[model samples]
Target: MFGPEGPSLRELAVQALSSVEHGYDLLAPKFDRTPFRTPGAVLDAVAGALAPAGPFGDGLDLCCGTGAGTELLTGLCHRSVTGVDFSAGMLEVARRRVRPAGGPGVAWVRGDARALPFTAAFDLVVSFGAFGHFLPGELPGLFRQVRSVLRPGGRFAFPVFAPPRPARAAFWTLLGFDAAMRVRNALWRPPFVMYYRTFRLGEVLGGLRDAGFGVELYPLPEFGWRADGSPRARLVAARRLTPRPAA
Candidate 1:
């Protein structure tokens, strides 16, 4: 579902064969042109939900990519917004795209998300579309790093879509994609670790609790509900608890 400006089939094949970071570096310039970028509609809905939860001070966008989620921070946060990503190429594009045009201040930092450098430095943090890059075993460290960057009672938020049912074509498509990815990684180096079906809500909630967050979910009304009456999408708000002193 890529546009004329998006990566060609040959280009995508090359990227799929490379390491995750290197593939993204090559894709950074045209990322927004592809369906892979988080849609503006989702961003707007998230911003609306977060507005009542906020008036947040400083914000961080974990794995910000080209800064789509960073744009949401501009409206919710008052002081400053920082977009941190491991890819220098992505950060370079984020820097250029998020330049201050009388908006909330923006900064782009290059670093690994699993080892965030800030400690209690942010009032809020958010991510989008980047979870697939992290394996299930990495969730603990990843959530811990996000928690480490937040002020006491600060939130780490992101939107999650409900999983497709087995009867649906979408479900089969995702299952096949994940299975192929597993086969590819098994045969490749620096493994491109994206799997659409792996980040289940139950598992993620458990991980958030383990990482010291009091977790809650808020429905995103924009996408409506499924036939079973459950919300089709939700915002996962994980508030960091105050750290306990060593006994």
Candidate 2:
């Protein structure tokens, strides 16, 4: 358990056994107290980096859980901001918990990210802490969906933290976590699909490019840099280059 407000060990176990959507539904009420929620530091850094680059007319938060990143979108978008997720429980918590005053009006939708319902509706799309739920093979279709939802020349942004170095304790910890997930999936139905190592930077860039995005990375200075001068955290800003063919 993370804290008094967070899910208990048994609660986490029950959630993990369910499908991703239902799992998040179970965890939604206490998600903010868990480490799984995107931290304020990352959200604030992203907002600062994006505010200068945009006053996007409309925004969407793909896989928005408990409205953490959706709140971030409110500050950047000039018009309405929508948060979409497959879990009704999570959206319920989001609508109740997040109240950003005097910015864009906010709404929540229940839908899957792989096949989002909107078409060229948002000027900007953002997500946080939701990628690992998607398998690497799902990236292309997922990126295509995001591209479809964005207007021509619109941007899809998300923050990606630099993976911990192999020499570090965190690296082994993540490795162990991923291996356990693989084993768990093999033994379980509805297979909770979260793997930290699958979403590499190179593969993701290629997927975005294939989905018609011209990608760029902005360093998040709050986290500093690695020994090789690589940024410890970088924001992926993928701009839609043109409209997809009508389908």
Candidate 3:
């Protein structure tokens, strides 16, 4: 329902009723046309933010939907780039659209993020617009999975926008959407499992810490600041800790 090129209302209804993986499988062809795709502006800002920290060896785009974040990795990583997701349909679309002309070789892997199929293989990892699918309690295990796939001192990065205030319509809109999803899941089989408000910043940071990451937040100046002077958006860069030499 995002545009002429986007999914129709009926299509969206069908998707909403399906399991998460199957829903995206149904939507994958037109997913980029939907507002659900990460915006180019945000991707550009994240690329700019990550440039100095990279020229990385190999990279992974965790939960790499239609490959927006995977495309971002092409310029930053030197060796090779891989996109992993649970949806075969999404991976098919990504394979067609995310070809890099002269940069690192790109590969698409179909696998769940919670059970990634790689070891300490990536020098960098990035994810965008996929966390809402994860429940709050899943963060610790999720972060640990991300950490497990990163080499010593490797970084897992993603951008987070400031949550809208209660006075704002956006806040209520997200709240209502999450509430509706809860009700839908309660009544439906094979729950869709997406919630807008579950990934609180404090909880995320704590989970990253518990996963043994040394975290840093960098303000994304492209989005400006809130009235309270905090950044409107921030990049969360969580680095995997290298093991100390044996005593």
Which candidate achieves the best lDDT against the true structure?
A: 3
Candidates ranked, most accurate by lDDT first: 3, 2, 1
Instruction: Give the per-residue lDDT digits (tens) of candidate 2, residues 62-129.
Output: 99989988998988998999999999999999999879878899999999998898989999999998
lDDT of the candidates, in the order given: 0.92, 0.93, 0.94
Regions of model 2 farther than 4 Å from truth: 243-247
Question: What lDDT is reached at residue 139 by model 1?
Answer: 93
- Model 1 root mean square deviation, Cα atoms: 1.4
lDDT of 3 at 58: 98
Give the CA lDDT, 0 to 100, for residue 183 in model 2: 97
Worst 10 residues of 2 by lDDT: 236-245
The predicted structure with the larger TM-score, 1 or 3, is 3
Taking all chains together, each candidate's TM-score versus the true structure is 0.96, 0.96, 0.98
Question: Model 3 over residues 1-247: C-alpha lDDT tens digits?
Answer: 3889899999999999999999999999999999899999999999999999878999999999999999999999989999999999999999999988998999999999998899999999999999999998788889999999999999999999999999999999999999999999999988998888888899899899889899999999999999989999999999999766899
- Candidate 1 positional error at 185, Å: 0.6
Give candidate 3 misplaced runs (Cα > 4 Å).
245-247
lDDT digits (tens) for residues 1-247 of candidate 1: 8889999999898889999889989999998899899999999999999999879999999999999999789988889999999988888888888765675788888899989878789999999999999989999999999988899999999999999899999999999999999999999887998999889899999999999999999999999999988999999999999868999
